[model samples]
Target chain A: MKYLFSVLVENHAGVLARVSQLFSARGFNITSLTVGETEDSTISRMTIAVDGDERVMDQVKKQLNKLIDVIKVVDLTNVPQVERELVLLKVNATRQTRSEIIEIVDVFRSKIVHVASNELIIEAVGHMIKIDALIKMLKPYGIKELARTGQVCMARTE
Target chain B: MKKTGSEIIIDTLLDEGVDTIFGYPGGSVISLFDTLYNFSDKINFYLVRHEQAAAHAADGYARSSGKTGVCIATSGPGATNLVTGLATAYMDSVPMVAITGQVASKMIGNDAFQEVNITGITYPITKHNYLVKDVKDLHRVIKEAFFIARTGRPGPVLIDVPSDVQKASCEFKKITNVEMRSYNPTIKGNIKQIQKAVQMILHAKKPIIYAGNGVIISGSQNELKEFVEKSGIPVTMTLLGLGGIPTDHPLSLSMLGMHGTAYANRAIQESDLIISVGARFDDRVTGKLDEFAPHAKIIHIDIDPTSISKSVNVDLPIVGDAKGVLKELNKIIKKCDIKNWVDYVSDLKKKYPLSYTKSDKVIKPQFVIETLYDLTKGDAIIVTEVGQHQMWTAQFYKFQKARSLLSSGGLGTMGYGFPAAMGAQVCNPDKLVVDIAGDGSTQMNIQELATVANYQIPVKVLILNNGYLGMVRQWQDLFFDKRYAGTCLGRQKNCKPVCAGPDKKCPDMIPDFKKVAEAYSVKGYRVDDPKDVKSVLKEVISIKEPVVVDFRIEQEENVLPMVPAGAPLDKMLEHGLS
Candidate 1:
């Protein structure tokens, strides 16, 4: 099963490394991790996606909470949550295929961030499923480069 | 008052009631050492030969005294060396605070000399770790480190201070109180859960108490004894729980698990109820999990909630400090009339008593340990290197008090005992401290002899000098058809695969331990004759200096009453190839 944890930690050096190390050393697989500074500069928020059974996920949550830098950890998997990911893909394009690519980008509500003579850099932001779908659609155009800002998640307000 | 980070560290340590520190000096920590020089009257710092030994020594000190052990080292390699020791303490839940000097703040991440991300590296191993970014935070960090290290399910904590921070001056304010909202640990068991546990105990007909290192960690030995006596239950200890109850007690089954006693294993197998206190059902203790104590209803009392139901399912789980929970349990539980169950366990004990061959020509390892036990009257603090010798010592040495038997239980780390013995000896100079070590394990951290000789610590190192890595050799002998692949420690380069037995001629042992001891300027003795065991042990124990006694025991011996991996505890091999 996939579990998502929203962890708020002290914005300190090596905090990210510590979180990643905890997962790796304990043999817990991390599907995706996104860390960024919160409104308060001294605090950082991390959205970690992990794959494990209930027992393993429980251990991961407990171990993460045990870290000194971590202030709070919330398992957002079972909760009503909103998750988003951003992907930037550079695809090879010819004059003939450029119109087709733009039409597909319009249908997905994505933007052509950069356009070159033979390449188009497409930027997409949505839930993980949508981002993955857009990437899958662009795969046949010969992806020149790709980068993803792993999933960031939040609990839905009641 | 204004003080440097170094001064704040010293003042805080003194305020925490820390009198001794184990450490090694390096460039990054030179300022801290210099500051320590001025406070020699308040602190006694033992300079270890290696940083790793410093950590082990501190762990030993912590386990023996129930105080948070302190060790310090420089950044990079020095800090890295402490990893194994920290991991060992972490696994066993020993309370220790390790202070390491990091590179200057500006130099961090620039790959400067002596720079390492120690805080990041020790994250998984430590209960909590801090990197002192500002000198003002030094005092608070030190206090938190000690508090976290000593409180609830204690484990190692690391504080990494950059060199610049140690030298930087800040307005020092003494922290008289520390309250971390996110870090409060549960001290008392839930009332409903405790009631459930008591109910389970009352209903149980054949009940057993399984104890572990937490009993020693919480200093709840008396509470545990009272609870067991009131409940009239048989007690079985883990390796770290050896001294939780007197080994010779009528209801005491010394140890249980892979290398545990036959009767103890049999009782665990047949018991209807198991009351586990402070013990995490480790894989070593639970063989073939599905078949482990299938008939038993488990009531687990542990300080750490995660440890409960982590390995084995439980009928009832009480999360609280062992001492607190046991006190509550003793107050509520009544004496049970389970004479039939008690008699059945006693019969099992009598039937499968621990025994070994009485050899006249060769000294068995068990005999050597028994002699040591007899000479010390089970009073000496026994530390051990992991292997056959460690198990034998745990089996033969009857520990009558908590914190008397200290070993790397969870990690099963080799080369832990020698330095650990030194640490224990330093803390208890008036008491005897001995490291019962194996030939292979002794060689791993043998350089600690220099530290012992330099400090004049009266620690005894008893090396059971079997020619092979005895435990692995035993496995190869049993399961691998005696192939002896890479298990022989002293095999000659040109020696035949099928070497002659001990009765015939065989290659001599390498790096003779007596000579190795002599090289470190310590007294050394070698005893090959079985008759010399008692006298040699007595002479060494009487010595006022660190001494090494090499006992050339029978080479083909293996620890018996052994339950093979993934096998049921009831199925034990009583003898070697019997």
Candidate 2:
């Protein structure tokens, strides 16, 4: 099973190391993690995706909460939530393939952020599945480079 | 008044009501020591021989006095030296504050002399840590460090001050309180959960109370006693939980785990309900996890919620301080008689008592411990180093009060006892403090003898000289076909790898302990005759100064009722002894 957790921790040096250390030390499998500053400058929020059974995930959550820098932890897996991820893909394009790439991007509601003589940088923002789908469509044109900002999530307003 | 960071630290420690500190100084902390000299009248600082011993000493003081133990060290090596001691304290939940000096702020990451990222290194082990780059933050950091170290599930906290910061000047403001919004620990167990736990207790048939160090940490000995007595539930303890209940009490099962009494292990295996108070189900206590207490419904009460259900599944978990939960349980607990179960447990106790063979020639370590217990009337604080000697002491020494027995339970740290005894003696100068040690472990931090002699602390070091690492030797003897590989301490260069058992021809024990003690200017004694054990112990106990008595006991004695690693508790090897 996959579990998503929202952890708020003190914005201090070595806190991220502490959290990651906990996972490595306890042998918890982390699927994806994204950390950034929260609304408050003094705190940082981490959206972590982990794959484990209920008992293992329960321990992961509790151990995260045990770190002194960690303030709060919420398991958002079952909650109604919105998740988003951003990906950038640089694809090799010829004049003949440029039109096809633009057409595919238009169909997916993504945009070409940069263009060079032989390359097109496409930016896509959506749920993880949509971005992955966008990358699949661009794979035909020969992807030169690809990068992703791992999933960031929030509880949806009812 | 304008003051240096060193002065701020001294003032803050005074405000924290600290009367003693254990520390070793170096170049990075020279400024702090210079300031300490001026405040010598207000505080007492014991200069330990090693930084690690200083940390353990502080740990011992904290456990014995219920006050946060404080230790200081210099940069790099000094700070690293405290790692083992801090981990020991962290594992056992002892309250300790370790202050380490760092290199100048500018030289921190440049690989300068005596520079280390101590706060970063100790982050996982410490409850919290601070690196005060600004002089103005010194007082607040110290205040917060103390609060964090002594509160909730108490553990070691570190404050790393750079050398330049110590020399920097600022206006020292005395802060009387620390407010940490994110650091509050759960104190009161939920009322509904408490009610549910009480209901479960009421219906339990074969109930057993499993206690741990938390009972002592939370100062809930009385509450635990009341709850156990009122409910008539038998109690088993972890190593750190030994003194939580009177060892001699009829319902008391001294300890339960790999080396626990056979009856206690049987009761745990057979019980229908287990009420765990402050004890995490550590692997040592659980043996083979899948088969441990398979039929029992566990009710775990702990201040640290992570400790619950982390190792063992719990049916009912009440996350709160032990004293608070025990008080609530005592209020609502009803008197229920499980006469049959009690009788069964009593029979098990009688059938397999903790006993050993009596000897006439060589002294058995257990006999030495038992005699010490008899002479002290079970009133002395018994600290022990790790190994067979430690297990024997735990089994034979009857602890009647909280904090009566101090050993490195969680980390099983060797060389913890001698220095810890010094710290305990400093805290309770009127009481007799003894370190029950093994020959292999006593030498780990034997340099501490200089500290004892210099400070005039009357701590007795009783070394059970077995010449081999007894625990490992026993394991090899049982499982490895008696192939004593690397377990021998005094093996000569020409000695065979599979040498026969200890005999007159074996090389002499290296670096004779009596001479080592004499080199440090402390009184030393050696006793080999079993009949002279009591008289030697009496003579050493009467000494007004620190002394080390090396008792050369039987070489082949192994701790009995042994449960092999990963074996279920009930499948104990009685070693064919009657």
Best-performing candidate as measured by DockQ = 2
After superposing candidate 2, which stretches have Cα over 4 Å from the reference? Answer: B576-578
Interface RMSD score of candidate 1: 1.9
Model 2 TM-score, all chains together: 0.98
Docking class of 1: acceptable
True contacts kept of each: 0.43, 0.57
Q: What's model 2's overall lDDT?
A: 0.91
Clashes of each: 0, 0
Q: What is the C-alpha lDDT of each candidate?
A: 0.90, 0.91
lDDT tens per residue, model 2, B1-578: 99999989988999999989999999899999999999889889999999999999999999887899999999999999999999999999999999999999888899999888888788778888888899999999899889888988999999999999999998776887798766888899998999999889889999999999999999999999999899999999999998999999999988999899999999999999999999999998999999998899999999998899988889999999999999999989988678889899999989999999999888999999999988987888889999999999989998899998999998989999999999999999998999999999998999999999998999999999999999999988888877888888888888876775788888888868888899999999999999999999988888889999989999989998787889888888886333
lDDT of 1 by residue, B1-578 (tens): 89999999999999999999999999989999999999999899998888999999999998889988999999999999999999999999999999999999999899999888887778778998988989999999899999899988899999999999999998988989987755878889998899889988888888999999989888899998899899899999999999999999899988999899998998999889999999999988988798999899999999887797888888898989999999988889999878999999899889888989989799999999999888888898999999999999889999999999999988989989998998899889999999999999998888899989998999999999888899999998998888888878888777786743343556688888899889999999999999999988989988999999999999979998798999888777888556
* Ten-residue region with minimum lDDT total, candidate 1 chain B: B498-507
Single out the weakest 10-residue window by summed lDDT for candidate 2 chain B.
Answer: B569-578
